[model samples]
Target: MTQIAINRPCPPRRRFGLSLLWDALSLHRQRRTLARLDTRALEDIGITREQAEAEAARPLWDAPEFWQK
Candidate 1:
């Protein structure tokens, strides 16, 4: 045959990398939302505006400690 298509599962390394990227993006979006929360909302969440700003300012690649393991 001149050519034939083959199906294969994603490689482990590539899957891990893609998963990491997705997690980082999700964190970025969540942090943005956190940063926009009003005073009441921040109070409801038990975090101050300063704390939210600090979290929002973090780099995307800086995943939470729990996520590292």
Candidate 2:
């Protein structure tokens, strides 16, 4: 006799929404940290303070393109 296999169900809407919210919050926190970093640390990371500030100024909804999927 042959046997059939079952696949897992897709994720629920609530989980996906929560995950997106959490990612946005995390990005906000990271940008806040970047904004708070000293000039020396920014230089060590190869970014100028102005650049860091510019990136940090972006809104939470401005996530990476890959994250859109």
Report the CA-based lDDT of candidate 1 relative to the real structure.
0.87
Model 2 per-residue lDDT at 6: 69
Q: What's each prediction's clash count?
A: 0, 0
- For candidate 2, give the lDDT: 0.87
In the range 1-69, model 2's lDDT, one tens digit per residue, is 999786987674443677778988999999999999998999899999889999999988788887766
What lDDT score goes with residue 58 in model 1? 92
**Model 2 quality (TM-score):** 0.73
lDDT of each: 0.87, 0.87
